[model samples]
Target: MNGDWLLLGRDGRLSVYLPSDGAALWRAERAPAGPWEAPRRIGGDQELLPGLSIGRGPDGYGHLVAWRPVGTDRSDLVHTTHFRPLLAPLDWQPAGHPNKQGARTGTPAVAVDAQGRAHVFVRNGGGGMSMVAQKEKGGWEPWRDLKGRGVQEEPAAVTGESGRVELYAAVTGGIRHWRQEQPGARPVPGEGVDAAVRPGTLRALATSEESTTVLFTDDDSGELCAWRPGEKPMPLVAAAGPGPVSAVRCVIDGHDCTLVAQRSTSGRVAFAAYPSQQEALGAVWTESGPELPADAVVSLALDADGRLVAATLSPSTGQLRLARRKDEPGLALGPWQAV
Candidate 1:
């Protein structure tokens, strides 16, 4: 969602969080708009694993989680936060490893609940999911098992409109899921839907105030499919993209829409817009723009002006690049710019 990377802060400014020597940030020079600033590393000497997971709490702090390599082999998850009036974040705090020996597989997922606690999830070295959340007063709870093996990739976690969270992991046979028993409480097992999904393509978007729908490419055919926990997976397109898809809900041409995009086989970003929950109606796909630096993490969000905007890390330049939906009725994106 918004906080995952290109965050629209409470102050109405935009902050693009990019992974770097630790992590980097690019905040809009002006609120509600940006001639973005040069990249600023969050200032830790630690080397960060390739991806980052950020959750913006209700209080406006951006809680960040990522894998920190411990020595040459083992690694542990670390945490940090950034907020207004402070461009530099607090020091990286060790959130600890899931395995007593250390967790080495899967990326971390972060989501902040209504009560302002940040929750982190990852597939552990034990071949199961592990989670850690903020305790009532502060700090983090010990890593606990959510229990599921064969997790294909990084799990997807999202907070519903109610501030409760649900996590989904694409596994060997189907989808594995967990949901908070109540807002801010520990998550419990939930019904899972059987489906064949590609690893690392799993993404969850809240389709309604109370429910979330996950999107992923079909493992066997590369088709994009969407599903809620109890429903059968619904195909959204005959073929999707080569990488994980990113989604954001917005109003397009006066109609409520869910816009999705990913790196296509041609190496450029491909996108589609469909009425929410109406994927059965059909998704018209469009290919646009040049390919990002290989393995770029793409993120989309509606600006305060309510326009579609996307940002991706440019590993080649070690900076951030951006593109916005053009001022046309269709899925046209203006030229990309290094921010």
Candidate 2:
């Protein structure tokens, strides 16, 4: 009930906004605020908590994951930090060592599992190496080196039913999936090279109480598709324009499945849905509230009863928003309300 949306601004600040009333909650600035709070350096001696990702632990605690300069450039160290929400503004409990010894880690992503634990993933420096971390009983656990894979980018995760954790990472060759429930597991590789791979990213969204589905955009072709265990990856939508697809979020209500995507080249966001997997699907493209201050987006979220909620930013200003449908056909775009 107490979760806020995070925005990464151009000025290198992560803006946190209240989801309830579209209010500006707070901002995490890069430069030190005052003498009491100095700029924290992380991973390979790089500045930690760079303006990028903001996530929530299952307990509804706010988290900001980022990287900083190790020395002067990309070759320097990058650290990953976790900020547990607190009563005082800018107050947070640090996780573990910012750096994974000396490995250069970048583009870190965080997700809260069903059991209320936070999981963090990053691209490590070792040849075909990556790291995964999870919050344990007392503190952040040791980083798990993911080997037997090529260099990867933009890793994302989600908690499935039965406390199963699924992770998707974008690799140069293709995308891969890893199940944490099984220890010492290598990433299960995927087939086919995406032509529109640049804009494509992956995240597992809940489809039901028992299933979490992985969604991604085809970089070369601009197609949106999803995959679940024991099933072939099915195409949900085809390319609409030339831009690379960046972010994707899936929301399932009853039999209706809505896929929302943002285009990097055009800066446009749209939604499309299918009544059921049996029905043909096409873009139902509706107008978004507005361009977020940074890259904040509106996607589908479900309540406990499985009712769908649209998570978006207010167009009037960069505020957070959540909207519900009328539960009728034609999939109308009703009032734009605050989260």
Of the candidates shown, which would achieve the greatest TM-score relative to the real structure?
A: 1
RMSD of candidates 1 onward, in order: 2.5, 8.7
What lDDT score is found at residue 304 in candidate 1? 62
TM-score of each: 0.91, 0.64
Best by lDDT: 1
**Taking the tens digit of each residue's C-alpha lDDT, what string does model 2 give over 229-318?**
556666777643343232323344444454554432344445566543421445545554444444444444433333444555543454
lDDT of 1 by residue, 1-339 (tens): 223577766676677776655554545545465576656667456777766777767666678887778886888878887776226677788888888555467788888888878899988887888899988797888878989878766788888878888898888888988999798778998888778877778888788877898888888877899998778888989654567788999877888789987766766767899998888987877877666666666788776677788777665566567788788896678888876
Off by over 4 Å in 2: 1-51, 68-90, 93-99, 102-104, 127-129, 182-196, 208-211, 239-256, 259-268, 275-283, 288-296, 303-307, 311-330, 337-339
Q: Cα lDDT for residue 213, model 2?
A: 66
Worst 10 residues of 2 by lDDT: 32-41
lDDT on C-alpha atoms for all candidate structures: 0.77, 0.47
